[model samples]
Target chain A: MNATSCYETLGVVRDATPEAITAAYQRCLGELRASLNGPNPPPPERLDALRAAYQTLGNPAARQAHDAALSPPTPAVSADEGERRPYPFAFTGEGGEYFRIWIVNLFLSLITFGIYSAWAKVRRETFFHRNLTLDNSAFSYHGNPIAILKGRAIAVVLLIALSAAQNAGPFAYGIAVLALLPVVPWLIVRAFRFRAHNTSYRGLRFSFHGTYRQALTAFVGYGLLAAISFGLLFPLFYRQQRTFVLDNLRYGSAQFHCTASNGQFYGIFLKPIGLALAGMFAIGFLTAAGGAPKLLLPLAFGVGTMALMLFLLPYIRVRTTNLVWNHVSLERMGFSSKLAVLPYFGLLAGNMVLLLLTLGLYWPWARVRLARYRASCMSLLSAEALDSFVAGESANAAAVGDEVSELMDIDIAL
Target chain B: MIAADYFDGRSSRRHPATLGLRDGTVVVEGDFGRRSTALGAVEICTGADQTLSTIRFADGAMCEIRDSAAWAAELAGAGIGADAVAHAERRWHWALAALAGAVLIIAASYAYALPWIAGLLAPAIPQAVTQSISDTVLKGLDGGLLAPSKTSPQRQQEIAAKVAALAGPGQLPPHRLLFRAGPTLGPNAFALPGGDVVVLDELLALATRDEEVVAVVAHELGHLRHHHGMRQLLQSAVVSFVVGVYLGDVSTVVAGLTALLLESRYSREFELEADAYAGRLLLATPASIEPLIDTLLRLEQAHAKRRAADRGGLFGATDLLSSHPDTAGRVNALRAMKR
Candidate 1:
């Protein structure tokens, strides 16, 4: 009768044979049907009770338990209950932790004239690795942090090479620049592999097998569409971006299995539409304001919208990166996690506008949002717990500590 | 179990702790609970307080107390820890998407621009067109433009004979002329403009094969004719000049300029008047009526190729040369020959 009970529908004794149970269930259904056919049927209450009782004891384990309970001693807890593994981790708000790392990374990166990107990358990787946990089991960074640093260095080198090539003559430079078309996607795949290899949760490591060319082609193709359409095809472009990211993402040592609904998959398209509409409204409003008001409106809207968007940025991020694992295994982790376009564009546009207006004064705020955005992507319970522990220890510790000391502190005079 | 106990006791507090027996030699604890029996002095506490009672041997030795729990928690909280490491795969995918978007946009923009740009630069001499013209002109002038006529029977054959004679000695092969009806053929003896020109058979019928036909052909020879092809080319170059002034290196500049050019339309009628000039040349020639009539018939038949070439014939209002007189009426006037 209970909503949670799955075993009650079939009528059979705990020790009944499978054949006997099937026969009994069929007979009960027959009786119910015959009664309904008769002019005067059994009361609805009796039928409902019968149905509930049958539903409850239909499952093999529940039938056995019911039969056993009617006899003498109770049996051990059912395997169903015992087999239900608790979720290893929980979601904890660690925005501050994320904020701190982001700030430190930003500061270091700036101080070193962007030279610290390698170190920043390593630190960032380390921070994310330390925070992630599964079923109380924390992940360990077994691969060298230097690998991440190395990857960043490679990226920097490639970037420098591209910039140099771009400055070269049109023909030679164009070829060089075009040559980089494949490199970015390649680096992304490599970086993912490197990062995945470095990470392990409960001794299970993860890796990605995404192809650089496929990712590159999809991106280039969508970009072409956007350009050909004069940016009018942004919705389609955004959808492609989400699909490529989600479909390519993997988790666990064994790939995690995931299936996203059409609704969920295409939900990302709404973001661009929303942003465009918002941009249009903003521009229109500014235009209508006229003269001096118009000038200030853009500046005000730019700053205000940016700050507001930054605040909502985490939600957008969480929604986009919403990944559900069908079955995460020890050997391969396969999962589908979407990287939504809305949050990314929102973050980018917001930061760009702020940068334009404040002349880089908004960099810190942007950095904080960026950190939060990245952290939002991570699924780590322990990191959240640790964050809470830190916050709790700092916020109310004076009171709790004094009370604890009063109780535990021993006095030699006594 | 023994190691556990030893480690537990040794790690009881932050301060250094030691154990010994009755002898002066310090006793060292070994695995399996075995210990050396010797007397020794051991410092349990260096400077740190040893009074905290909660400190126990089972708790493991305290290394440096760095308050790094905050940093560790922050790292963990931000998914900078193992969890973040675990998610490195997803991050890579995200990066890939961003990269793909960038590349696609650039490539597509270039693809869309190619056809439009090509169309804009269409009038510029295609290498094929320039080469063909050069070959045709040089062959026609192979006799050094003022060569003494040994091949011709008369005192001086017309320019057509001279050029045809020169062509044979110069080793320049003549191009085949395929005729089709054109709307611009009139009393006019017209040149093919480039590559090859069709002379009207109607004009040829009006004059003797050698007299009127040769002179009419000479004018065309004057255009293919003495370096006129080169001069027409110069005029075309001047007319279709492109100012490659870039406003800025930005794509917006190119896009705006292209949009403006696409909206602008060119006027027709310029080519139609060129047909009239050909007619004036034919009138001055001493060619016969039969040759002129033959030229007209030939031109009427060959006009189709001109219509095919332009998509709109010279007489069609939308044609580029439509401003000139109708081809049919001009032919009628040429037929009424009073001269």
Candidate 2:
């Protein structure tokens, strides 16, 4: 008999596990192949039905939607009551624990002559991801080390080729650089896809759906202007790139949205520039008026620059983070970041001092401190419970793109 | 029994479940239903301290245990040790041992393996490539740092002839001599990758004897014979590549510094090789190795006086950072070779 539902097409029950569905699909495919090679081949309609069923049921989000379409709609509940409940994020990782992990990773990587770096990356990412908890559920990373290793190998080869070309001749060097330009956009998109697909929260995988064309427009087209403009048009570039990345991101079927405008990005960047200029003017005026001592001028300039340098990074970080998260929404749920610049600057300055004093032995502790503070500053604004979200399909992406971007020192951060 | 949150993997819904072992079978009981499988059939990812541990059933359902300590103790009570990797990562001593082992391996590789590999690989590079590279470097120097030779034509011709006679005739990949006036460089004789030996005017003006000029030329010839310039380039390339991979980013200031320090160490070995080569070459000629030694000492004393006058100017490379070996050690080695 011809089946009406995907469950019947797969010859499995509604409550069958993912493992059972996959097994049934494989068995049906094997039988279909056998019949095609036999005296009488099955109709194309049978092949269509099998493929359509698997496509719908293989993805958790699509299956949930399909099931909902089949069943009667349940009555809605008003859980919000015109108010949002804030669920604060937590990071449980410790410095001492991470230090041990880092040392072991470094040791294994060294002994293997960098072959183990792929595995080390996976383990380090796992440690960070699984320690980050939101609403009693920790995140997870599922990157394959073998894929990472293959990507790293390719990246190393490319790096060696580029360096060798420089020594070969000017013409060869130009050819090498020109050849790499077209692949840049593709690499950026693939890297985003790989990172997003491997990250999960509450069994629902995050996905990046940005294409190469969009990456070219956002990274290359906007990036060139930003570089040549000498920090004037950088805010617009930042906004465009952020929009390109965030707008295409999804958790299950819910799309992430960035509502922050270009003006907001400009506002964040300009505040520090204005402050630094004003500081220089004040210093100049005071020295010119003979109000400040001669010996104190250099000290004053040093202090002013140091203070500005410390304030500038955190100021932009806090503002952009708040601007992004405050305006970002995933379907019905929203996010909030109450990160203050002063405290973050203090923490960063302290971390830097400790890093220098300890000759970088304080790295693990510094990371933990920053993560904990940032997590403490972030919270999820959800009116409804998080359990209703469905898991999305994981896209196929290679690690080579991610490794190549990393080797090229591209900072694709949120 | 331990409490855990389970996901069937087909859906995002979480089911609060009780997990336990019943006669070698791992059972998961929740409001959704009961699922059981052989203990060995399941996959357990017991992470390090403070991190969550996950157990996956045969049906692709996963149970997340938040209380890792309790789960770990339960597994231990049931005669199951933690995963090998987590165990290794958890122990402090293992991490310490790994750090020590890494340091030893990196040090040994830097000391023995890198030079041997670079030396092996250098001769394989095409001459055309080296020629182009040398041409570019010479053009770059000529554009800014080097001026036309101000030495008189007679003196330059005579010294060049003497050096050519010392090098002998019919040599494959013959050396080409170039003269430049480098007031900034003081007295320096260097070899390029394409067998071009650049002798600065200051070097000739500083040398009292034609034998001293010939000795310096012989050393430059030694560098060409062994392909030392190409080998140095290859070695530095390898070092930076290794450092870049280790740090995962080439843009880091530390990586550049590390490459510089390592390259300097490798150059010291090359300097020694060149010294020995010049020594053997001089022994074959009427002149002894003494001119080479005297010229080196004089150059060192002149640089030392300049260093003191400027107190090692900001742009000036100090003796500690110099690529060449110390004059005293090099002279002692040359004397030992003569003996």
Best by DockQ: 2
Q: What's the DockQ of model 1?
A: 0.01
* Predicted structure with the largest lDDT when compared to the true one: 2
**lDDT per residue (tens digit) for residues A279-346 in model 1:** 66877766776644546756866876655555445544455455332222211122223345567667
**Judged by TM-score, which candidate is best?**
2
**Candidate 1 off by > 4 Å:** A1-120, A143-146, A169-173, A232-253, A261-268, A271-319, A322-414, B1-339
Which lDDT tens digits does candidate 2 get at residues B59-151? 446889887888888888778887666788899898788778878888888888877887887788888888988999999989977899988
iRMSD of prediction 1: 15.3
Question: Candidate 2, after superposition: displacement of residue A396 in Å?
Answer: 2.6
Compute DockQ for each candidate against the true complex.
0.01, 0.51
Per-residue lDDT tens digits for candidate 2, residues A137-240, read 88888799999999999998998899789967899999999899889999889888889988877666788989989999888888789899987888988888
